[model samples]
Target: MPVLVATVIGLTLIGTTARDVVSVNPEIATAATVFCGIFVQALPFLVLGVVVSGAVATFVTPDRLARWLPRRPATAILTAGVGGATLPGCECGSVPIARRLFGDGTVGAAALTFMLAAPAINPVVLIATAVAFPGEPLMVLARCIASLLTAISMGALWAKFGQPRWITRNLLRPTQQQDSRFSTFTEAARHDFLQAASFLVVGAAAAAALHVLVPSWMFDHLAGQLLLGILVLAALAVVLALCSEADAFVAASLSMLPLVPRLVFLVVGPAIDIKLFAMQAGMFGRAFAIRFAPATLVVATTVATGVGLLILGAR
Candidate 1:
């Protein structure tokens, strides 16, 4: 609520006739269109995520998760990735869910893997990708494979090198331990939506500003340079902080760029963004987020680029 009020105030301060100015300026009009398109397209999915995440809080227990995953780290990571593909929601909900599922040793790795994988490769995101890139099936496959690998790799790395002490916050707390199931459901949904909405507005504003400010030639330059394109798009994903369900459309909007770079954008957005970083720092700890977020970005970008090369080629 505060975020929204501040944004409204900021806009009003820009000018009382801001809408009139925007309508007259071609570049500003274009940016406004893109922002509206992304926000409107993503809003339904965001709501759905809130509802599903609430349900996840209500029903998905640590004991149930333990039963589902294998004991060994390798197998558990794999299983967690597959399991994540089943859950259809956004990254915000996954944070607390991951907190609930967090455990020692191998299980801890599995929970983190599930957190990364669920948002990027889940059925909802996959379908959205396919819809966004109707004629390109390889794009869908590349995103799925790359996102899955990123999750699994992170899990393996954490299992091998991550220290529990780094997680300075209460990384493991039963979300519904003290509350009734119905209260938990409503509260979880409300909290997730409130947390996500403010970030969504900020992200959309950044995207809109970039759309208007970036030189037209800049996008043209990205088209020919494959590696640079990949890196730029991945970084854009972090900057935009778009919802997983809506990023594909944003990527698709950049029809000027090659499919591989757009794939990197899709793969990286849900994995690590400003909002996710904030959520991680708030939910887990700054100590954990500072280390984990950067690592995930590198891993996601590298994995996405590699998979894109293999599956979609440098084209």
Candidate 2:
């Protein structure tokens, strides 16, 4: 209700002020449109993410998942990374599920893999990538492969050298120990959906604002420069903090950079971004999120660069 009222007042002010001004205030108009568009675009995804996340939290038990997996960390991580292909939601929804998995004693490599893969390799993200880069089946394939490799590699690295102390201290608690009425699938699903959706809305709104306010020419300076383009896009991804589901659309629209650079945009988004980092820090602890986010960023950028080169050569 407040948002609606604000929108009406804003529009009225803009309408009234336009006539009096010698020239229209493009910046103000652009800012308002961008802000509103972002809110609208992100609401649905945010709602969906929260519902799914809440459901997973409520229904899926730590013990149940543990029984379904092997004791080996490597095997568990592989399974978790690939399992993302089966999940339906975007990156925003994955954080809660990953946290839940960690809480359920599915920590270490497996939990990290789930965090990366669930957002990047999920069915929804893949389909969106395919649609975004038409006539380029390879783009989707590369994205999936790059994302999976990055997740798996990072998981393995963490398992080998990472100190247990660095892992999210909060997840050290036993999730199975918690008592809740979320035993039923319906209850778990509902809870997961709501939790994930709230974050998704926040992310999508930010991304939409970037889409409207940031001009395409801003990227023109980096066109055809892969390294600079990667850095710039990665920086933008951090600032925009867009959900994995909708980021491809924004990337596709950029059209200013080369295909490889655009690929980097999608790859870097899920693993490390400002919003995700903030959420992770808050939920997992500052120390854990800080280390994990930077590590993921470096690994994702390297893998994405390799994939980009491969695709460019093949073409």
Candidate 3:
């Protein structure tokens, strides 16, 4: 029956004109392309993340991670934010790595910090920001400062109010397991990819829909107002669900908006967007994401606004 259906579908495709269908409703085709682009772009990074996560599961223990970090949560969170530069990937990659590194107490806080900071502060993203806003070196600086501040704030907040019970997913445990090392690695990677990828599809679809639905005139009008621009762009960041590595260009394209609001968009997108929110909610829990995401948006926006004013001189 499946084979017959497949054959019929293949015949129908051969008989039908795809171009005519697209000509009738281009939005559907455009949305599909956008969705695929997002999914494809994140695939490599997601794979790398899960592989690293698997390696951590197989080799690195919580006690080892705990011993490597500072004794105090505050200090460790700061350190993690700084150390985020070492990971050369986007937010999609950091989620699994952070999950692998997450532990009880200070380690968890540090891991959360690293997760928020890594994609935003990494050299690739910084260079992209610099390139996007040429002659505006301060934009790059503002982005770095705001992103680090946001990351550190979230880490500190998590240390104070985040409860482990809120996280539904647990890190893979190598001990008390019967599987071979290679098998364990493969399993972990497979599980992380499937889970993250599924939610990623949902986010990508939503983003594509927004791209098609929202009018360009709406942005032009909103960009004229300072507070409204910042808030709208911040919300746009969440809605667009752009990859951190590429978001600078997207923010830069919003030339109608002032530097400060665009800066807020860049800062807010990587720290907490639709895609990252979905991934975090899956890895953490709805309870945690509900609290954490809003706080991140607030902190990121405030920090970006302040840093932008100081650096860009009210521009």
Off by over 4 Å in 1: 1-22, 171-178, 282-287
Instruction: Give candidate 2 regions above 4 Å deviation.
Output: 1-58, 89-93, 103-107, 171-218, 312-315
> Cα lDDT of all candidates, in order?
0.83, 0.69, 0.76
Q: Write the per-residue lDDT of candidate 2 for residues 48-121, one digit (tens) a residue.
A: 54455445545554446556556678789888888767655455556655665663333656877877887888
Could you give candidate 1's per-residue lDDT for residues 207-307 as a string of tens digits?
A: 67767897879878888888899988888899878778767767877777898888889999989998899988987789889999999999999998889
**Taking the tens digit of each residue's C-alpha lDDT, what string does model 3 give over 1-315?**
455468769868875576567557888777666766666655555566556556655675445655677978788998889978755545765776688778788888998998899878877678767766787898888899989988998899889888988777665656766788899777766665565555556556765675678687876677567788888888888887766655665565556568888899889988988778888888777887888888888999898888888888655
Alpha-carbon TM-score of each model against the true structure:
0.86, 0.74, 0.69
User: For model 1, what is the error of residue 98's alpha carbon versus the real structure, in angstroms, after optimal superposition?
Assistant: 2.1
Residue-level error in angstroms, candidate 1, position 288: 3.4
TM-score result, candidate 3: 0.69
Better of 1 and 3 by TM-score: 1
Q: Against the hidden true structure, what lDDT does model 2 obtain?
A: 0.69
Predicted structure 1: lDDT: 0.83
Off by over 4 Å in 3: 1-66, 174-220
Clashes of 3: 0
